[model samples]
Target: MSHKRSFVRRTAAVVAAGAAAFVLAACGGDGNGDGSAGHGGHNATASPSASASASQGQHNAADVAFAKGMIPHHRQAVEMAGLAPGRAQSAEVKKLAADIKKAQDPEIRTLSGWLTSWGEEVPAEGAMDHSVHGMGGMMTDEEMTELENASGKAFDTAFMELMIKHHEGAVEMAKTEQADGAHGPATKLAGEIITSQSAEIERMNELLGKD
Candidate 1:
C-alpha cells in the first residue's frame, strides 16, 4: 500500500510540472503573457485594410466626376499652349502659354493619379468632345480647328481668347468641386484652380485690351 501511494505521488508531481512547462512555453512564444494573440493579431491585421477602405470611401461621385472631367480639360489647354511657341507673335502671349503649360501639365498628372488611386476611370485625351460636354466656356470643334490653322498675331489673339474661355470653364468646374466634392486633396486642388485661373482670366483679358 505504501509503495503504491509513493508511485501515485511521483506521477502526479511529474504531470503538474509538465503542465507548467507547457504554459510557460506558450506564454514565451506569444510574447503577451496572455492568451490574447489570436484576437489581437486578427484585429491588427484588419486595421490597415479598414483604414484604406475608409479613405477610398470618403470620395463622393462629385469628386470622381471632377477628376475625370478635369483631366481632359487640362489636356486640351496643354494642346492649345503647345501651339503658341511657334505661331504666336506677341512675347506676352508666348510666355503666358508657356506658363499655362508648365502649371497645368503637372496638375493633369496629379488629377489622373488621384482618380487612379480612387479606382475611378481617368479621361484620356479626346475622350469627350468639348462642344458636347456641356461644360461652361469650352470651345467648339470649329473654333479649335480655326485656332490651330492661325499664325502670327492672329495665332496670339486666338490663343488668348480660347484660353480665356477654357480657363473660365475650368473655374466653373472647380467651383462645383469646391461646393460638392468630398475628397480633401480634390477640394484643395479645386480651390487653387479657382484662384489661379481666375487671375489668369483677368490677365488674358488685359492682354486682349478688353474690359
Candidate 2:
C-alpha cells in the first residue's frame, strides 16, 4: 500500500513540473513578441521625424534670400525672353531667347516651391517691376518698355545688350549664394547658374562682336 501511494505522488509532481515549463515557454514567447512590436513601432516613428527635421533644418537665411531674389530676377528675364520671338530678327537670337525662357520658368517654379515649403512668402506675379530693379541683372521699367517696342535687327541688338547686363547680374547673385547659402540644393543651383549664365554671357558677347 505504501509503494502504491509513493508512485501516485511521483506522477502528480511530474505533471505539475510539465505544466510549469509550458507556462514559462508561453510567457517567454509573449515577451519576445512584445519586444519586437516595440522595436518596430520605434523605427516607424523615428523615420518621418528625422526626415522632417532634415528638411526644416537644411536651409538658412542666405538660401532664403537666394530663392526670394532669384524668383523675381528670373521672372524679368523670362519677360525679356518672351518679347524675342515676335521682335527679334536673328534666328540665333530667337533661339537664345527661347532657351532662356525655358530654363528660367522652371527655376522660378522651383524657387517658389522652396519658399513655400520653408514658410516664406513667395514674390507676387507683378513683383518683377522696377521695385526689384536694384537686384542684380534686373532691368528698369523703361528698358523693358524699350525692348518691347523694338523689332528686327534693332530688337536683336537691344535684347543682347540688355540680356548680357541681366545675365551678369544673375551670375553675381549666384556667386553670392554659393558663398553664403547653407542649403545644399540652393548652393548647387547657384553653381549651375554661374556656369550656364557665364556661358550665355560669352555667347551674347560673341553675337554682339564684343568678344
Candidate 3:
C-alpha cells in the first residue's frame, strides 16, 4: 500500500510540474519583469504569421527561404535578447539587451503580419538545424548547458560572449538574405538586423573588453 501511494504521489508531482511548464510557456517566458531570463530558457511569441501573411504582397522561393531560415534565426535572437537583463553584468549589457528586446519584439509582430499575409505557419517552434543554413556561431549544447548552470557575474560574462557571437552570425545570415531573398518585408527586416546587430556587436565588444 505504501509503495502504491508513493507511485501515486510521484505521478501527481510530475503532472503538476508539466502543467506549470505549460503555464509558464504560455505566459511568454518566465523572465523577470525587467525583461531578462535567468539561465537557460526558451521563449515563445505570438505567431508572426498569425496576423500578417495575407498582406505579405509578393513572395517566391527566396522569400520562403528567408522566412524559413529566419524564423529560427530570429527566435534565437529573441532568446538571447530576453536573456540579457538578468544575466549580463554591465549597464551597457543591459541596455543592449533592452534594445534587442525592443527592436525584435515588434519585428516579431511584423513578421507575424507577413506570415499571416502569406498564409504560412509562423515558423517559431522547431528543432532547426543551423548547419543547413551555414550558420556556425550557434551555441553548442554544452555551451548552453554552461550558461544554464552559471549565475551572477559569470552568467553576465558568458551570456554576453555567446550573444555577441550569436549576433554576428545573425548579421551574416541577414546580409545574405538582404542580398538574395525575395520577400519584400522580410528582406527589409534582414537589412535592419544586419545594421542593428552590427552596431550592437561593436557595443558588446567594448563591454567585453572592459570585463
Candidate 4:
C-alpha cells in the first residue's frame, strides 16, 4: 500500500509539472505575438507622419531659385506699388497699385520663409538695387527714379506700363517654376501667380488702352 501511494504521488507531481510548463509556453507565445503586433502598430503610425514631412520638405534647385529670385522681384513690385498712393492721379491706377502691394507683400514673406526653411539666404532689403537688372522686365534705377519724380496722369501711365512689364516677368518666372520646381507649395504658388498676374496684365493693358 505504501509503494502504491508513493507511485500515485510521483505521477501527480509529473502531471503538475507538465501543466506549469504548458502554461509558461502559452504565456511566452502570447508575449511574442503581442510584441510583434505592437511593433507593427508603431511603424504604421510613424509611416504617414514621415511621408508627410518628406513631402512638405521636398525641394530642388529650381525651387530654391524660384524662392530666391521671387523674393526680390516681389519686393520691387511692392516698392513700385508704394509710389502710387501719393503720386498716381487716376483712381483705377491707385487701386491697381494698392492691389499689387497687397498681393506681393505676402508673397515676399512666403518666399523668404521657404528660403529660410531650405537653409538658403533670403534676399536683403536692398537687393533690388543690384538684383533687378538681371531679372526680366525689372525697371532700372533711372526708371524707378523717373516714376518717383512724376505725378498725375504721367505717373498713372508710367505705373501701368512698368507694372505690366513687371507682371510679364513674374508670369514668365512662375511658368518656369511650374515646369521645373519640385516643391509642392512653391509650385502651387507659381500657378496662383500665373493666374492672378495674367489677369492683372490684361486689366493693365485695358487701362492703358492697349488691349
Candidate 5:
C-alpha cells in the first residue's frame, strides 16, 4: 500500500510539471503584457488601417458638399501659389504663397478622404466649369496669363497685386461656406480660411502699399 501511494504521488508530480511547462511555452517568456507567445511578435501590432480608423471623421452631407466645392478652391490656391516661387521677387509675396500651399495641401487630403469614405467622386476632378463655381473672386484667364508672362521686379509686384485679389476671392468663398456649406469640417475650414486670408490680404497690402 505504501508503494502504491508513492506511484500515485509521482504521477501527480509529473502531470503538474507538464502542465506548467505547457503554460510557460505557450505564454512566451513574459508576455505579461498579454498572453502572446514569448516571441513577443505574436501580439497584434497597430496597422495603418487602425491609425486611419482613429483619425476618420464623421462627415455630414454638408461636409461632402464642402469638400466637393473646397477641393477646387484649394486646388486653385495651390496653382496660384506656384506662380510666386518662379515669378515673384518679394519675400512677402513668396511667403504668402508658401502659407497658402502649406495650409491648403493638407486640407485637400482631408477633404479627399471624406469624399472617398462617403463613396463619392472627388468633386474638383469633374469637367468642372469654374464659372458655376465662382463663389466670390477669381482672376480672368487674361489676367492670369498676363501675370505668367511678366518678369523681373515687375513679377514680384504683379504677383503681390494678383494674390491680394486672389485672397479677397478666397475670403468671399469662405464666407459663402459659412453661410451655405453643409459639413461642419468644411464650414470650419471656410471660417479658418476667411480669418487667415483676410489677415494675409492686410499684410500684403502693407507690403505693396496698396490704398
Candidate 6:
C-alpha cells in the first residue's frame, strides 16, 4: 500500500509539470505565423525599411536648387525649340531644335519627379516663381518674344546666338552642381548636361560659321 501511494504522487507531479510546460509553449508564439519569439510583438524595433534607407541617401541645398532651377530653365528651352519648327530657315536648325525638345522634355519630367520624391516642390507647376527659377539657361520674356517675332535667316541667327548663351549658362550651372551638389543622380545629370550642351554649343557655333 505504501509503495502504490508513492508511485501515485510521482505521477501526479509529472502530469502537473507537463501541463505547465504545454501552457508555456502555447504562449511563447510571437503571433507572426513564423513561430518566432519577440518579433511582431512588444519587443519589435522601430527600424526603417530598405526603401527608407534608399531615400535617406545624400542630398543637399545645391541639389535642390539644381532641380528647381533647371526645370523651368529646360521648360523655356523646350518652348524656344517649339518655335523653331515654323520659323527656322535651315533643316539642320529645325533638327537641332527637335533634338533639344526631345532630350530636355524627358529630363524635365525626371527632375520634377526627383523633387516630388524628395518632398520638394516641382518648378513650373505653379510652385516656383519664374523670375527666381531662371538661374540657368532661361530666356527672359522679351528675348523669347524677339525670337518669336523673327523668321528665315534672322530667326536662324538669333536662335544660334541665344542658344549659345543658353548653353553657356547651363554649363556654368552644371559646373556648380558638380562642385556643390550632394545627390548622386543630380551630380550625374549635371555632368551629362555639361558634356551634351557643350557639344551642342559647338554644333551651334558651327551652324553660325563661328567654328
Could you list the CA RMSD of all candidates, in the order they appear?
6.0, 5.8, 27.9, 5.0, 10.4, 5.8
lDDT of 1 by residue, 46-71 (tens): 78888877866678889998988888
- Give, for candidate 2, the lowest lDDT window spanning 10 residues: 35-44
Alpha carbon deviation, residue 199, candidate 4 (Å): 0.6
Q: Write the per-residue lDDT of candidate 4 for residues 1-211, one digit (tens) a residue.
A: 9999999999999999999999999999888777766667666777888887786559888999989888878888899999999999889999998999899899988999888988999988878766567586888889999999999999999999998999999999999999999899999999999999999999998989942
**Model 1 pairs whose backbones collide:** none
Q: In order, what lDDT does every prediction score? A: 0.85, 0.89, 0.71, 0.89, 0.73, 0.82
The better-scoring model by TM-score among 5 and 6 is 6
In the range 1-35, model 3's lDDT, one tens digit per residue, is 99999999999999999999889886766345325
Flag regions of model 1 displaced more than 4 Å.
1-57, 130-134
lDDT of 2 by residue, 167-210 (tens): 99999999999998878889999999999999998999899994
lDDT of 6 by residue, 1-211 (tens): 9999999999998999999888777666424345333444323442345445555556778988888888777877888899999999889899999999999999999998888888998865533356744556567778888999999999999998998888888889889989999799899999999999999999999989942
Over 4 Å off, model 5? 1-62, 124-134
Q: TM per model?
A: 0.71, 0.73, 0.63, 0.73, 0.62, 0.70
Candidate 6 or 4, higher lDDT: 4
Better of 2 and 6 by TM-score: 2
Worst 10 residues of 3 by lDDT: 37-46
Instruction: Show model 2 residue runs off by greater than 4 Å.
Output: 1-57
Tens digits of per-residue lDDT for model 5, 79-123? 778888888777767888899899989988988987887899986
Total clashing pairs for each candidate:
0, 0, 14, 0, 6, 0
